[model samples]
Target: MRNVVYMAVLLIVANEIYQKPDMGLGVFMLVFTLSRQLQDITSKLLIGAAQFESDINYMKIFFDLKKLERENIDDTAELIENGDIKFENVNFSYPNSEKLVIKDLNLTIKSGEKIAIVGKNGSGKSTFVNLICGMYEPDSGVVKINDINIHNNLTAVRRSISVVFQDFGHYEATIRENITYMINVGMQVLKNYFN
Candidate 1:
């Protein structure tokens, strides 16, 4: 398109020079304005194309996650009476990584037991907590709550377990308000379940 514009401008300049040499200044201004507009349009097109490709990649990831969720779905809602957590030879690694974050880990935390997972940076402390919370499944073995496999039934685990991460969200609300907000959400879920 720029080439076509340049060719047209050249023809116009030639015609102006042949008819009236005094119109050379007007022809130069027209050419300059057209080139600037062309540059602006080309830049906008490039940016839009880049943005479109990024959105497509994002959607692909979104759909892949949705499909994974569907595969792991369990419609039955099992209420957890005891919060006992047991990890039996659980082995796990992050997706696309060969390094095992949690390897052959066997642990048991009976209900009402207080425990702390302490480790240095890059250790699997966070990964272990995620396993307990049913956020990620073990590559081998099982994570169980009250002897029930959490990967097959997550609703029970979600209702009974709550973890506060180091980077927890800080809403601009009072402590009571923040606490009550989660209570209200739970109540709404119960109401919907009964209905």
Candidate 2:
């Protein structure tokens, strides 16, 4: 309200001064000041609009995830103490493609044993890891932990398993985030003993 009164007084004074026969320069100065103020206001609005658009775009990804369908398999297993895992004559292919990504795969890992998989790009390494983690079902044959098929009891199998995937953007995240961002223990990350 105070600013409005001041502006009205200034405009009344300017109007009286503008009526003078030789005040063309005063008119020019008033027009230039108004134009500069308008530009500053418009520029601030434009910046706020841009920031709002960026935030909406980032939030849309999480909204889309909430609408996604979750897999439903109603089976849980006993707690796995031995951690013995085996894949017997497994074969698999992704949806919408006939090409087999994993074919005739077989393997076994006794409890507390360490194993490494190495391959060139497009090899079945990631696919094999996904199968072991119960992310995907084997199209044929069975994946078992202590003779309990993963398809029969994925919830219990996953409870005892921890997997660190290898891919672009897999690293470069904070250590707490690197493990699925499950914790926020300040900035420091746990050391990768292998690295």
Candidate 3:
């Protein structure tokens, strides 16, 4: 639609220029053509500005998430080695919500221990997992991996543990890409261990 309007304007000016090659018609055509081009350029500039702003916002979020993933690597790695985890007087609630999900929860697991958490829907089981994964911080108290405070040494704490959420999604991407991403994460865990 915009292109058609521009073309129509250009055709009208071209017809006038063809009818008379005089100074007045030439001046009019030049001014009209300049005005039309200026409008188109301004419109494009505004759209480009909006798109650039959106791109910057998206990049900011991406970088923030990456930083968090790096911070949690340590605790996750430690958990892999010892298979121990503990929550000490932990309390948690979702952001902007008044209800508490986990309240003063205390739990511990020994190295090489196998444990299962059973609860009905909305019974804070998922929220507890999220707390362990560093997705949400406890309102108070501590989550420890192998007796290390997760908050104090986030990377170290994260390196000690790994989690597979029941609600996790499988990407629509190829199997190779999915497996590669997981392996890359595992390699990162190895690096954390050696360092």
Q: Give the clashing residue pairs of candidate 2, or none.
A: none
Clashing pairs in 1: none
Residues 1-195 of candidate 1: C-alpha lDDT, one tens digit per residue: 767866787677777777998877777677767777877799899998987786676457544643542333344776687778899999999999999999999899999899988989889998899998898989999999878899877866776677787755333468898678657755765454444
Count clashing residue pairs per candidate.
0, 0, 22
TM-score winner between candidates 2 and 3? 2
lDDT of each: 0.77, 0.70, 0.72
| Candidate achieving the largest TM-score | 2
Worst 10 residues of 2 by lDDT: 186-195
What's the ranking of the predictions by TM-score, best on top? Answer: 2, 1, 3
Tens-place lDDT digits, model 3, residues 1-195: 676777777777767777876645667667677868877898999998987786676457544644553332333333346546799999988889989889999998787787787999999988888777766789999988767676766655455556877765344358798678667766875675445
- Per-residue lDDT for 21-138 in model 2, tens only? 4766676567557756766687789998987786675467545654755555344345576868899999999999899988998889998899888888878899988898788998
